[model samples]
Target chain A: MRNLWLFLSKYNAFFFFIIFFSISIVLFVRNNSFQRASVLNSSNQIVGKAYETTNYLKSYLNLAVVNDSLAAENARLRGEMKSAFYSDSIVKREIVDTIQHQQYSYIVGEVVNNSIHHKDNTITINRGRKHGIKKGMGVISPTGVVGLVLNVSDNYSTVQSLLHSDTRISACIKENNAFGSLTWGEENYDPMVALLKDIPNHVKVTKGQHIITSGYSTRFPKGIAIGRVRRTGVKGGESFLNIEVQLSTDFSTLQYVYVVNNLLAAEQEQVEAIQPAK
Target chain B: MIRIIINNLIRFVVLVFIQVFLLKNIGYYNLATPFLYILFVLLLPFETPNILLFVLSFLLGLTIDTFYDTLGINAAATCVLAFVRIIFINLTVQRQGLETEPEPKLGIMGFRWFFFYTLILTLFHHLTLFLLETFTFSDIKYTLIRVVLSSIFTIVLVLLSEFIFFRKKER
Candidate 1:
């Protein structure tokens, strides 16, 4: 013990420096911004795998909440099927109803990781190219629009969450068809609110009205609900109504979202390209 | 020994609070701000255990990192500073002073020795920290300016504290 202490005392500075300095360098390279899209990211393979492990351990604790949301979704789906059968009066409810469309298909996936506090927040899902997920695809929960896919690796995909400052989604007022883009305000703090802008002065708007995606770009389908207008305003001399939209998706509680794959996106882009400059 | 531990513990808490709450809010222009928490690493007793110095500086850097959200940057720079500290002491303090003056406060060490010691160490720390923060050679000029200005700013604060607290010899 005396000899060990003597050795450590003699060389402890060099010893400790070597240990801590290597750890710092390891973390430094891992956290470098250029490597953001790699496995070093918060939602990349390494951290995602860790989160999944932890969630697996604690999932039983959250069984009730998970069951409740799943039950609600299942009930909604069953109700819609019943209504469809009754209204159609063609195929009996016994026959399976498959209303699959070629244009847009949803790939359900779990949010392996997510963040909200950063200027540019991102979400990562277990779904990837292996699961027909691709970049620029729109992600939505059962309740509302989640975000657009920013980057995708083989087994994972990162989403540009709505909480990000630069995330702009095309939105339209449900009551009046007044279209605008939704953006997170400069101050992205508690109770995250998106600013809906560019609706002309002529269109009537009101608080608590539903705003939804316009399907302008092939990212989101038309009428995918986004948020409700919380506060309304007018910027200086601009002939547009400036409004704050309280996003319906409570990002903190988000667990699962469906990645929207627009199979016809390429065709749409090609068709739009042929149009001469107006 | 206990008194030394108590004093250092108190200084750690006070300097961290001052750096995070007070000095952090005093950003006059966009570019440069003083980092007073380096004073904790600077003023540690000369004869403190090498392991303790390393650990203390690591914790101090991590605390500042928590405030700035520049994770790993401060910790690495501060670790470098702490590693270089023993060499700095060897270079600056005379053998007689090391024996007589355990704690090399400016009042005891006299103005010139104190200035040179603080200036060089502070510059080394600021250079490492700002370089890590930028981590790019393209803005070398801007980074150098930041290093120089912030080092001077931190030095001034350290000297001010030394004069305020240690001027009277508590015989």
Candidate 2:
């Protein structure tokens, strides 16, 4: 017993290291999993508050750029307004029915902290549970798709940015509607680029073609702009095309974003979960 | 002793803030990110208990991870760094020679020794961090690029900070 105690005491540092390392690995694995919200993330109250404070101070430096983007968005929105369009058709019918139900809503949020460098980048937004933010909800910028909410606290949330290695958004080519999953951190490490995989080689892929969300998932609405195709190629013995895309949202300048709240998500999930008898 | 504790505490806070707020946003083409927080762990007093060193390293890593939104990756890497630190110090730094210099500061350890130490430790930390982050051998080449680039970035920043801040040993 004495020898055992002595042995343990002798190697106590190694034991301690093992313990700490195991704890860290456990935390890493647990938190990195999908849809699981852990307390150690940036969404924690104190950490979130600290980031919020610093972001508030730092936000002033990017005011001009933010204003420019906001102005551009406003102009785009203005052009889509009814007043901006000239009615050429004389025949007009006012048929208002309850056929179209609200499927999605947007909750505006300011990005408190964001990164594109790391293999799995994340963004922290100022809005959270109190502002209708939740895990698995889709987030979008004024320009295009941004990310999906991974965790949400009382007043803050962490978004799994599109640049994350695990992030896969169902996207389709606008020209031919050849749907595939969009992913980052694969072959290319560039923040401005991503890969569109699972696209069959038979599809006609051209440079500069637009890629938008397929709306196959409940997270995002259909037809949200994702990116533009930079190039496409089929690797030897591979059935899928190796297509590169230039992301529309400038993640470096990301400030304001909208957290999509799918009102019909619960219903969709419920319907999808219904098992058919074999 | 109290002075040492207070100084290290201040350093901990300052390093964490600088790393997360200032250096976090500065990366070259999503490749190199300078993790200045590891300096706190590397600069701990030589006489610090091995257990305490590991604990402090883990805490420092966890704090940085909280802000970076990488829950345990930094912590895991820093733990490995702390372990390596113990082994490296045991192998390189003689026990009896500790009277002249209390800690492994750039000013006390001189340029060559400190440079090698920082380079080796930073490389180990970055390699572990990037490997664990990607968790796949498929992108080994890209990950290596990131590891080397980030290690250089971190080593340069660490050396620069050590030179600027730490004073020469007062004989």
| Best-matching candidate per TM-score | 2
Give lDDT: candidate 2, residue A57: 91
Candidate 1 - CAPRI tier? incorrect
* Candidate achieving the largest lDDT: 2
DockQ values of all predictions: 0.15, 0.76
- Against the reference, the lDDT scores of all candidates come to 0.77, 0.89
TM-score against truth, every candidate: 0.57, 0.94
lDDT of 2 by residue, B113-146 (tens): 8998898899899998999888889878888998
**How many clashes does the backbone of model 1 have?**
0
User: What does candidate 1's lDDT look like per residue over A117-215, in tens digits?
Assistant: 444467778888888887778999887899988767777787888876658899999988889998873533343578888888888788999999998
lDDT, residue A140, candidate 2: 96
lDDT of 2 at A115: 87
For candidate 1, write residues B1-171 as lDDT tens digits. Answer: 899889999999999878854575454332456888988888898888788888888888876764443457778888888888877787766777566676868877788888888888788888888787656786778679878877878888899988888764434
lDDT of 2 at A45: 90
In model 1, pairs of residues that clash are none
Candidate 1: TM-score of chain A is 0.78
Which residue pairs overlap in candidate 2's backbone? none
- Off by more than 4 A, model 2: A34-37, A88-97
